[model samples]
Target: MPSTPAIVVTDLVVDRGKKPVLRSVSTEISAGTVTGLLGPSGSGKTTFIRSIVGTQKVKSGTVQVLGHPAGTKPLRRRVAYVTQDASIYRDLSVKANVAYFAALYGRSRHEAMQAIEGVGMGDHADKLAGNLSGGQKTRTSLACALVIEPEVLVLDEPTVGLDPVIREELWDRFRALAAGGATLLVSSHVMDEADRCDRLLLLRDGVFIADDTPADLRAATGTANLEAAFLHLIRALEGVN
Candidate 1:
């Protein structure tokens, strides 16, 4: 993997109505790798993602994507954000939704079809997005992001409600994207997904508690699994060790 950093954040501080969501958070995400942002449901994962994507306002900090400031016009085409909710037009066909985004990036219908198939949505390309299942909708949303071929892709709990089979399929696609040199930062509250990442950024209540690989986390905590390792960290942080 390349050693260059795709994203860099320093002292990022965000607040939601006087309550701090992320406090003095700073980290570097390596290029061409899958990095997992793991924490509990309210551990500021979404807030951090919004900061990187330039959607959420921060109280203090600097966020740079591919060397440019986050949310700048130049970075718009190079960075793609797939939200937790499906961002497709409910009334449009799956192919049409993907094609629409493709057109925005000056892509062709052929490329759009390729992106649709890349997410394993080829069979449902003609189906209305509103009529599809939850997993199918998520796939369509992913296809929309893939059509642009972004250099840095940020996903927020993409597999939240997916079954085992579909979740595995989506993760395989993520690995393929990373192998193709796209940097990915995926957020999840599920500790089991930690091993799927090349690196891990563990957060708890707006503070970073751990940043290491799955193996390193296990080794440091002397735990058999990531879930147990996470619990160990939490307990240590709370002075219960």
Candidate 2:
């Protein structure tokens, strides 16, 4: 049986200056499942993700996380969010950065090492962040997010600049985390990664066009691949409007 939704958004609306970013967006993300927010570069994926994480200002809507309103004080330690921007102590070693963040969450240093190892950074843990490669830095950022053992993790374009091998390894780790009952909301514009998600939320221009499992997406569109499936959805939506 399926569990309750980890997050839910209803009639979500977000406006930036004079422009409206999201338009009546609504969706329920299943707990303990990996749900990919798949879209193009300017499709409001980041904005929607920020909304879910309770950082983006909403014009009107409700975002509920774990049965409580988003941004509530109680959820501060329960939700871990990692943005695309790689911000860490350049002078600090990878291990130190992770351990420090864990301490901020009231977690022990041992848990920090486990998180560093989870992101495949145990060997490079002692390496200075300033000297690590871009991919390694990204891994360090992810390890920091894992320190709190959060129930919900929201990552924005985590694999964007990573190499194929590192991307594959991170995806495997994401699956492992989900299997352990952690809900992950990973945003990516890369269509190739769509099929890896347990479920997908297809977004374009701040609106959801389709929400279904990858297999269902393929079968409904009668397409052999995810790219083709997304195209079919776009055309179908175009015809309706």
Candidate 3:
């Protein structure tokens, strides 16, 4: 039998508050690759991420992760998710939070501290999560996710509002994780960040506009950059109609 994809979504349809958010979406994320989910606000990027993470109830379709259905008990420890909002404990120190979450994954304190240092948060490891800056808290949450050494890592807007240096650093870490045989699904609207991913899943209006490598997307759209490529594809589709 063929091995399963890292993540597979087949004919996924989701509705929130009785209003459809995703419409018949389907895709396969390859293992040990970085797939960037790109789109405008409210383009169903978050919904798609949630669907694969097993946090969103789908209207139809199936989402499978590592050969098992998404949100299954077996996946709880294998999949790591970092939302746009920092889910760190306000009262806990960064190290404390990372260590606590690590324990839940049956990881050691050394692994927790290594993750904290990976995110450049070691200097502030003892600071209260609430006291850290927004970007710092986000990094702390990222550290918590990394401590578990998950098979699949899902990150949403992980580089928002951070310095360019920090963004580069994080992207390096992501590449390293992918190199280590982890599947990474990262969502970011920032066009520049698209270049860092192995593949880009360009979503628009609850559908995939383009699903290809960043280079292929640029070449096919005849654009020099990802943002221009997005507009180019949309306009080409409009012209087709």
- The TM-scores of all predictions, comma-separated, are 0.99, 0.97, 0.96
Tens digits of per-residue lDDT, candidate 2, 1-241, equal 2568999999999988979889999999999999999999989999999988888889999999999889889899999998897668999999999999998989899999999999999999999999999999999999999999999999999999899999999999999989999999999989999888999999998899998999999999999999999999998888943
| Tens-digit lDDT string for candidate 1 (99-198) | 9999999999999999999999999999999999999999999999999999999999999999999999999999999999999999999888999999
Q: In candidate 3, what are the lDDT values of residues 1-241, reduced to their tens digit?
A: 1134799989999988877889898899999999999999999999999999999988899999998999999999899999999989999999999999999989999999999999999999999999999889989999999999999999999999988888999999999999889999999989999999989998998989898999999899888988889899888878952
Q: Over all chains combined, what TM-score does candidate 1 have?
A: 0.99
Q: Highest TM-score: which candidate? A: 1
lDDT to native, each model: 0.96, 0.92, 0.92
Ranked by TM-score from best down, the candidates are 1, 2, 3
TM-score of 2: 0.97
Model 2 C-alpha lDDT versus the unseen true structure = 0.92
Candidate 2 at 202: error in angstroms?
Answer: 0.7
